[model samples]
Target: MGRKLQRIVEAAIIERIGPVTAQDLMAMSDDSWGLIRDQITDRRNGKDGLVARCLACECEVYIRTSKTRGIARPLFQHYNGSDPDCPWFQGRNIKPDAARAAQYQGKQESNFHRLMCELVGELAALDSRYIKHTVGQYRSPTENEHGRYPDTYVEWDDFGPFVVEFQMSGTFQTEISARCKHYEREGIPLLWILFGLDTATALPQSFIDVIRRHRGNAFVLDQAAVAASREQKTLVLSCYLRKPDGRLDAPKLVRFDALTVPRSKIPYHEDRIVGSRLAEIEKVRRPWFNALAQWEDRYKPLRDLARPQSLLLAAAFSIVAATNGKGRNYASEHSNISAMLNTYLSTKVLSPYSDLLKQIIENTRSSSIIKASVHDHLRRYRDAIQATNESPEWILLRKLLPEALDPVLREELAYLDALPDWANPTSE
Candidate 1:
């Protein structure tokens, strides 16, 4: 939604419960989102009134509806301002005498080297470009020195040599200077994107004079412009060229930052709450199943597979599987619920995996992820794990299963076991 439609959108849409509209917001990663313009809630009777287009770019948006389909895509795309000096390019025409240009390119290349060293765990270091973060000083470290690589980058898509350095929120001059020097010495090309909440990076004349002294190109990323680029998904794997004067133009933007949420946020609680916040999540998420059940209704015809639903289901599970004094007691005393809830409000609201709230329950019963936290999320789905530990279902589920009963749903089995003698899974 844009500045004008903000209030109107607030009025029209009902989240996670009714028919989702073209204007609703969709989760990108845990950190960001892209709004849908002309969203296609349903493609009815061989014709279409549902269309999602990006407001900034005015591009059409689409989503994949099939639970068991291939290549499902959301229709909104976040606009990342174009990279006037991104590291992906090989440099159009190298001039032998343009030594400064070569030096800048080297800085870009070295920065890519550093970025990959950081991103290596999850993404491919092909062309050996990725970002590595560290204390602004002291001994430097590389990703390789750490351990096994990251799962997302290793298994899924690849990485590019260009690394994006978000100098927003925390770009202390000292830290910036140190990081820049590190890369400069590394002789890699870097896309130094800088910005503040108020606007894009327009380096001061003094700053430009300083950059002119450097061997690299720095660009600024415009958050507002990027937020407006919701044509297909909430975000993109792209970067932008910030005007040195810190001004932003809507059209010449780049979309970047795919997989905005880390794998860590996954295996999250599917069913968090049934309150207003949850309702808002649903209004944007609402897309009813064929059974005529509201998207929020638990008894829809199909099994719960949406990521959002899965998260809720996981929370319901935690209500039973909880134990006292065991895990992150994000909620314990009623006073604490506010803090925990706030965390969700701040983080879960914009997370792409938040959608996993729908698909999480299904994933919990799955073998795709082997981490115990997945079980933990499901274990304490209702409240905090530690709080729910004493839940009736938790005790019973543990009693019914053998030591580690993962193959068959140990939780479900426990529920069945807790039933009276007349009722059992065998009865099914």
Candidate 2:
């Protein structure tokens, strides 16, 4: 069997109304269509309400609901005497791929596409900052830039024209690259919003590749906003993005206007640190601190060995001690730990403390005291920096230390670097 017909048209006394899809008619709803029929009906009442028309030629048509015999979906049908030349006048026997390809190349937009464009355009108009800016399907003002029209364009005061594209189907990678370069040459920023349905499930490779070119890998929309729009008949346009991870981030609504710069900081709904995982990490915090403290207690006897070596070890010990059995103190101790590590890395000639530093590094592998101390310290430092709305690149360096260290120690450092900063602590 062939694919069911998805497209239809509406008829008028003098002209035809559409090549509109059945989905578009569904979105218009029965009540809205009833009003349109009442306003446009003939005075003599001789016509049989609003007449559905054929796309290729003017011919009266009828609605085919889901219950209609032999039809798997809602559609429009023509009477026996309808136009023979009409492309869609025949029943569902056309080739599926051919029909789909034609649909993509056709001028008619799908219901989802039209709705997305309308919502974005509506949001753009309501913002006061863009009140004077033109918002719609933008036609470039110059003859040289003619035929270049974005799906949704907002001419802004500060940034000039901002072009947006909502991609719902498969796209070519070469086309994606060329379009980005074209926009760059034109000095316009092009924002791509992937179809919410696809994004919420799995992103297409084309969308993924294009977004990666823009220095990001994730794009998300709030599920709540989608629900609210269905009920309120208004568009609340906001999107959240991040570097693509293996897992999807929590869904939450944000202001649509926040995406002004493609690479600017976009806030997430929840702090990445406050989940059940953090609670588990908290369980190990004290034990880690205690181990580090005990290590310091044992090393105190070495303070009289030599001034240079003793001072460096003492500073390292002091830094770990300041953590105070809590992850919160890691921020303040960051500089001390950094200075000690830098000094250790800079040491060229072997000395009394060289073996001791190697021992400390080795302990980071099997010693719970060393591992927990490092974990809690880095976690606290991450929370502090993230609280300031900054990326924690400084703490990330813990993962990049020289390979001369034990592999296990390097792995632990990498683990610390990878932990998510879910929530910012209240105290510094």
Candidate 3:
């Protein structure tokens, strides 16, 4: 390979979003690219953010912009401190602090940022429930750590304490993560408001980071939001909801109190990331569940749908649904799930799925199938058939029942604190 090819990172794997190449990055929409760019920054900072690692050397990588004909393009670049031995290493890189200083030119806070902070504080104080509001003041930690200088701090009569940080220019991912963790540790609601959002054609990576932390709901205290707050006697924000296609919807004026504050302390009106994804997964499986519930003949519907592996999936899902207390037998007309499983095992239809079935049974709620009878049946039929993870049936099952099958996804969901109850295999 040439020196340039060796230096070019061919691909990278982003946490939660899988693999992407330079071509993939170029194909992404502006908003999508912005989110990936911010996530790369976050991963470089620490373990708290989405991790993007080079597929070549498995070292951390970030998105670097290269301009061609006045049009900016993105490519993956290893971090400055990454392993120098990696084939994709691009010579020496500048330190993050130096780059940040050059970008800001020693001006950490702009006048517009200060003015916005004061204005947000003023609007927050308009509510009758507002007890006190402060701007650019030190907020001492309630516990053992040192305090932080929040842009705006507000204490409500009944709603409790809140902190608002305004995004002006080039807020580092480490700083953002530290502040979020700090406020969450102190049990204070932290809200990040964006400035100059109305004028930007494409959002900067820093703004994208904040928007994603708010779960795809970007809040801006713009002129219209200011007027709305004045009329409503409370803080109002111009909320822009991100669509699935990585584009923003029309801005809507939302009251500060109307936001949904998750456990992360970052609030949003709607969850466009996690909630929407789960809903999509449900939508994909709903028809299968419906077909299974109303199943008359197994060979016709399961075979005619899509993959030949649907029969195994339907059988597995039927067993799981029965254990979940749904009490519907879709695999067979047998009186119980145990009978259906035994029949399949004897016929070698579910023989390749023994291991998969055992995992599902162990993860779900208590059941008669958990008794030794089922295991005995599985063990008896275990030697009769070959089971492999490389099979299409196994792969499909992992995608269909990720909460139960995919350990990496399970860990990711648990780390986000969004693991559903059905996915909790150890609930017993």
Candidate 4:
């Protein structure tokens, strides 16, 4: 008799978010789970991916879909070849290559997959801007070490190169990630078009992964899209946008240029991930900003919220306001930011937050605030402040002003070239 399939993994410890059980995985919103899933896939592809380890043996784990009574749910599973010694080990996973071989029985690409590539290439050539297009051509990157052979490669006169990979079968996460990163670094936009999406009883995990990478967009090249592409003189796709309710919205024919091409080059119609997160962060800080903006004299409006834990926020915002040319002092009755900071430091009110304040000033465009006079003032209060990097204020500031205070978030935004002008540190 065949050995019993390994029991399902129960839980995983995500790097930044802590513990996530199978139930938690299923309960999370689509975007949330998608972010975690994409990070796991990225990690598997050898990028600086999210670290999620099995709760049982501390082995790295990835999220996989499990169907119960026709309803699909996500569950944690150890990667292939995980330690059999672990209680949660599901035995060795069938290698992706071995599974593909068994499914195709020897063929690499399905006949339909090839036909879809040819059709996409033909449709891509409908646009007047199209220069050339190839099917399954080897492409060497201008910068990266390895090269890739995209399913369909299209070039435009002014728009440059674009890649279209047709997803027809189960694809390994590593394969998905490598292609995504390779094209992104090569300055080429990549689009993954799904086949048999309309006929699938339940969408496969591979299809779901591609949709998530596209920020909940699922593209297809149906007859409608083909006709639309020809009429519009541009590559058009039938785009099904995944709603927050975990269901696909009505499919719409969207032009290729209509899609938002982020720095990662994964084209999506809606920014379901980053845009939502930044909006949530902004929502939390909106009230404080409003209150600070209307500051008249130091009264209950400011004092009521100014506990020791929150005083740093007030002072920091005051400095930020000054830098933005507002000249508002929400923290103190002083006329200017330098005077307000000097008063707080001399009185030992903001002394404990000296390190955090210095970091904020140095990293903002307001570095000029640290003049010779201010340096002398800081030296006088140095003994009292006992400035150290381990300030608790950093915790508060990192969340409020992440662009300037949080190194990780700053680096991420910088990479995307999306960092706001006000948050730029190098500006004089």
lDDT accuracy of residue 5 in candidate 1 = 17
Clashing pairs in 3: none
TM-score of 2: 0.42
Task: For residue 190, give model 2's deviation from the true position in Å.
Answer: 5.9
lDDT digits (tens) for residues 1-428 of candidate 3: 32333356765656545446566677788788888798778766774667777765667788888888998888888887776555456764423344644434322234345656777778888899989988889878888988999998999998998999987666898999899999889878899987546433777888878888888898876546776888999998889998887678888999999999887888998888779877877887777777676666666757455433556777678767765677666777877778777888777767767887787777655345455677877877865455566666677777777767777877756655566766665553
Instruction: Judging by TM-score, tell me the better candidate of 1 and 3.
Output: 3
TM-scores for all candidates: the values are 0.22, 0.42, 0.63, 0.62
Q: List, residue by residue over 1-428, the lDDT tens digit for candidate 4.
A: 55555467665666544446566577787788888899989988999778887765667899888888997788898887776655566766433344543544323235345656777777788888888999988988798498889999999888888999987666787898788888888889999988657432567888888887887799987656766877887888889988766567878899998898987798988766456657877887788788766766554445355464455678888777767777777777777778877877787767777667777887776676545555566656755544354555576668778777888877756655556556776764
Q: Model 1 TM-score?
A: 0.22
The lDDT for every candidate, in the order shown, is 0.30, 0.42, 0.73, 0.74
Tell me the deviation in Å of residue 295 in model 2. 4.6
Candidate 4: lDDT of 292?
68
Q: How accurate is candidate 3 locally (lDDT)?
A: 0.73
Q: Which residue segments of model 1 deviate by more than 4 Å?
A: 1-162, 195-428
Runs off by more than 4 Å, candidate 3 = 1-105, 108-112, 136-149, 185-187, 198-200, 297-301, 305-311, 319-327, 332-349, 358-389, 406-416, 426-428
Error of 4 at 419 (Å): 5.3
Give the alpha carbon lDDT tens digit for every residue of 174-232 in model 1.
65555444444433223344332222344455344222222112333233333333332
Work out candidate 2's RMSD over C-alphas. 12.5
Q: Which lDDT value does model 1 have at 182?
A: 43
